[model samples]
Target chain A: MRAAVCIALAVVAVAACACRIPEDPDGTLDRVEGGVMRVGITESDPWVELEGGVPTGGVEVRLVRRFARDLGARIEWVDGSEEELVDALKEGSLDLVIGGLTSKSRWKKDAAFTRPYVETTTVVGVPAGSSLPDDLDGVTVAAELGTEAEALVDAKTDADVRPVRDLGRAHGEPAAAHDYVLDDLGLAAGTELKEDKHVMAARLGENAFLVRLERFLLGRSEEIERMLRKEGRP
Target chain B: MTDRRETEGPFRRFELPEELLPEQRKAVRLEWLTLVYMLSAVVLLALTLGQSQAMKAAWIEDLLSLLPPAAFLIASAMRTRDPSAKFPWGFHRSVSVAYVFAALALLVMGAYVFFDSAFKLVTAERPPIGVIQLFGEEIWLGWVMIGALVYSGLPAVFLGRAKLKLADELHDKVLYADAQMNKADWMTVSAAIVGILGIGVGLWWADAVAAIFISLDILHDGWKNMRASVHDLMDARPRRHDAREFHPIVDRIEDELRKLDWIEDGAVRLREEGHVFTGEVLVVPREDDHLVDRLEELAHHLLSLEWKVYDIVVVPVREIDIPSRDGRPRSSAVGEEPARSP
Candidate 1:
């Protein structure tokens, strides 16, 4: 019995030594080429929008789909709030994140951003016929949670900023840009609040993925512009 | 008058032969590498703290682990210094002192981490891990933890393997102890990674469980090192290479002395001072004439038995004097008389 146990132990030791993972120096590129590229998205109109519980159309969706094809890989989409998506990107679960993300995202330190693909102005939206509040101090303004618009309102205005999960339920009025379609929500866009550039983010130190993404974006500028024009929004 | 004569007695200081130049050079190089790796581990661990409670524990272990290598480096450097009025035995025993100190540090760290982890397990306190937004996704904190473990573990394995061979060649207990600590580092780090990954997957108890296992392993090593070092400090009979029992060097020496034609019977006592032996023996000679010369020849022969037997004093005994009723002469009486060929 003891001899059998000794032989078993020897076999186990040999097996343990034999089975070791070879180091992949260029892990990001290897993952992108042979594994699923996880993309995180937030609900933003004209950039990433859901139609009947499926991502129907968006400039970001098309661009990412093309990039995945170029890498000979499949894409897995994860949807969450801006903070959740950014957190996923930083922790390396998601290779890329897209949702009309502004270049001024607070998570810049944690992840690298692609060059801006589009630029637009931030504006305050008031309920139709209500008129914009002047010298707005102590006014309660709602912005989509975890978005740059929320950060902008908090930093650039004395107004009491309320973060709403969905802007449609923002009741009376909220702040957003033209693409968000405040007019369709029975609200009117006020004076431009801030000029902002939109970009995608990737995990920090994933230089290969970032380089490929930047190259893809640079090559598809004309297509992106055309898509923007077709959507009838900046 | 007797104290003055003893002070001026023929106490011919013995010196072990210097190690081959190449081996000495290799040892120095190994120590430098160990010091550099230890410093880097400390810096990396400090930078990677605050990720989780497991991470904090790892950082503390790394901090405590630095003591052994640091002690080895200092002791090895000073081990060859000449004896002075302040230090009568030169600096050879520094290695043994370092071994004891390093063992103590390990024991303390092991006990502390073990209890702390057990407490955390009982409390079921979930570790709060923060996530960073990359590209547009929320990645869990597990990947960061794995990366930190890989960074710390790889260098430690390399350094540990490199030092172990050199420690053996040099017969350095302190270096050997330090090397063991470095070797076990990867196990702790890998366990921490698994724990963090488990917690990431919502297994809340895994981190503490892994920590407890790691601490137990460390405690086992610490206890072994402590026992060995304490035995050396007390001048206990040296153990064999495996350290399971007493070494056969003393027994072999006694046998050789008894086989000699001029000697009736002999007693051999050996004690380790760091990596070397310094002890005395009482030989009952068949005749008193030319007894010192015979013993000198025997002492030289015994020294050749093991290079570690650097000092041995052989006395010509008239009879088996059991003064203390233990059949063993007082070490103090035998210790004063240096081996001199008359």
Candidate 2:
């Protein structure tokens, strides 16, 4: 009984500890202020890329800009290679990383991925005259290097897969002239291709941030779909 | 000190036994001191009000000045009175009523200062000059007010401390309530200090605004104290074990009493009327004659605790073995009766 009373008191004390006021009287910021928001963007097409040394707009860029304004912070865009983006996040050089990145098993060890904003599908686009390999047995499928789509091809088939600099290049006319272009773009790309789907990809630990960005894009998805259709047209 | 035959006068006919310890006498003496201090402050404030000439000052003074005298007069009267025909519980409620009246007056004074100052702040085209002076020099009236507050506040702090001690010793609701009122005086004094500082800073409306804030605080405190006093007076069940020190002792007693399987469905209620613990155990007795003796021994064990345990009453309830419709004997049961006062 003494033990029980002591245990009860201990439980109360633990509960009291949780609710103890922080020594610093000032409260935690529900709204952010007073810092440069370092946003890491992979140099992927349409979503993010440097055009003439000026970082141009994309679905992710517009989404983050609004968040920056609300937070009273300046947006410092840090463009990097896909691997460097993850490296920058790990090194604490970047607060966030955004691109057409999917939360796949391969990236799980490196970075945290936010919830999917959009779903994409895997599709193969061959030239009008060229015979396409259905099984991808001996044929090479062109995919963006270090992408989830490339990983899927590596996982699913023993096909000869060639890596492209970007998915945009893979889905372009020149790359399409080669074997088959596995269009590993977002669901918008799939709807545009009408023959395939693309899985949207994001870095890790950004589920809420990605969800918010995706919702914002989803609100203006029609315009984005039109742009993707125009950009990726073979 | 007076003869018993002269009891018809405005004095007590009965005397308490000389057996009361020195500490108990000290408690009574302090209670009297609390009354006297409150009354004197009231008289001083009242005279100050009468002596002032300005319309606003005099009016505010008249309102603010009534609290201490009223509280003292009524609480003292209640303390001295005998149990009457109409009120079987005597006029103990007079303390609460007196506190209520005093609190109400303080609230009014606070509000008056708040509103009057706020009005001047908003509407006055020109800042009013500090006109009132008490001595030969042009004494800063605000400073004088602050000084008066300090004079009232310091004494009240001591009085309140003494009253709280008295309340603890005698289990007195009135003195404790007065102690609460005294706590409010500290806030009032603080407000006066700020008000004076604000005046010197050329924010002529500061004093009044501070008073208003102070008033609201007093009102809240007054309402709470009154509510508590009323609740206590209405024979509110004594809190069992809110104190930290006595909780372990109480828990032991409760656990021990509960161990007897035959003593089914009971609670041990403990209360502190003064510094003494008064406990009642509602119990179901077993068939064995030794059960009562054992319970008495347990009660004695509780009384022998280092903490103050004045009395213990073990209320034994006979276990009625009521048979079910199918003629099966029921389990042991207990019910409450007013446990005999220890």
Candidate 3:
């Protein structure tokens, strides 16, 4: 019995020695500083536009790029659908998700959003020669699936709502896609549907990344406003 | 002439009850296992902290619970040491002391948890929890909390169950108390898990509410253990589960004493010293010429019981009836009255 106890104690000591040292108490901050920051990006124009199948410059893309540089880390972007991106953020696979996401998102419970960097209104696009209605009483309004515009139309309008794959092509040739489709399709921009504050989403409780992004957005509001006017304006 | 028997202190090497050796060995083994379990629990707890307030509280409780098994292990080892000049009753009382100490530690921890959780509830403090991003997936704080609860809770249940039978067989109150703590530990962890899941579901108060219930359970266990250990330390006769009656061993001793011819009547007192009993027998000896020899025989017979009755002073006396306040004679039944048992 004595020998067994001695052996057990010795084993315990060795096991204790071999035990993993606890991770840094400030996990998110340490992770950010450890080199790679995984970012989830959805395909949205003027925020995360694709050029020849490669992600190119956009308002949010540039902002996050600077933010990543500030953290002394390079961004590793994972492209997915908005819901998939939010799910990835919640599962800790993505540090942050960007692509013109808004502060008021259905996935807010699973992901934390930075303060709004830009506020834009959802507008109805009609053919350029068509008369726009004050209210969508009998209009056939189209919104992309899973977008705030879909929710806004559902809540505020008694219109014949049509769920579309691409809002830009909803009023024109199905293959046509552009930054703002109203002019290209000879459609007219109509009444503002809903105002949304564009924000960046991060994994819930990734306070370090969220705070840093919020601070960067706050500090660079003027620069972002200029960038929006140049490329984000519609 | 030297009094050879007088040299035998209460600490003198007395044979352990033959049936208890295996149980004692089992108890030792169980304690070692408990120690290992607790050590791993501590490691897991450290790894799992900062997940949620409920998780943190459970971890702290786990840390505090390490005391009982450690005290039991040391006491169990020391309790078998032979009697020395300094400790006349041998080291058996070390078990009692360990029991009291362990109980006191539990009480302190329970009080701490109770107050801390109550204060949080009163202040309406919502603990801030973080999510860990794994492989591009955001895992909510609740999943981590569930993982932590399972890690800390499962082993406690096993250890608690493993120790209980050994505690009962050896009649080791300290080990029994430790086992009870281990049992309570898993329950506390479960409550913590519920609390964390509640937090996940956006019921901010659920965590504190669950914590309060956990604290209350701990406090209840603490009070019970403290009362039992304190009773043991005070040399109170060990009682049955009903608490109103003495252990059946006391009844057996009294019945056997009453059956003896020379022991016309007797009063038996039994008190537990650690795992054994030590007491006195006041016998109303019959008018026999060999009264001294009869008294010795009765003492030997009393000691021979399987109840670990290590010390018995057989005092021979004449019947003395006391009158009640109303002038009626009071019945003197053996083992019916309270007396000091050392």
Worst 10 residues of 2 chain B by lDDT: B124-133
Best by the TM-score measure: 3
Runs with alpha carbons beyond 4 Å of true place in candidate 3: A1-234, B1-15, B133-138, B240-245, B319-342
Q: How many steric overlaps are in each model, in order?
A: 16, 18, 22
User: What order do you get sorting by DockQ, best first?
Assistant: 1, 3, 2
In angstroms, the error of model 2 at B95 is 6.3
- List interface RMSDs for the candidates, in order: 13.4, 27.2, 12.7
- Candidate 2 wrongly placed segments (more than 4 Å): A1-234, B1-20, B46-138, B162-173, B239-256, B259-262, B269-280, B288-314, B318-342
Candidate with top lDDT is: 1
**Candidate 2: which docking quality band?**
incorrect
In candidate 2 the C-alpha lDDT for residue B276 amounts to 35
lDDT of 2 by residue, B231-281 (tens): 434534443222212335456566776776766645555554322345566
Query: What overall lDDT goes with each candidate model?
Result: 0.68, 0.48, 0.67
Off by over 4 Å in 1: A1-234, B1-19, B132-140, B320-342
lDDT of 1: 0.68
Q: What's the best-to-worst order under lDDT?
A: 1, 3, 2
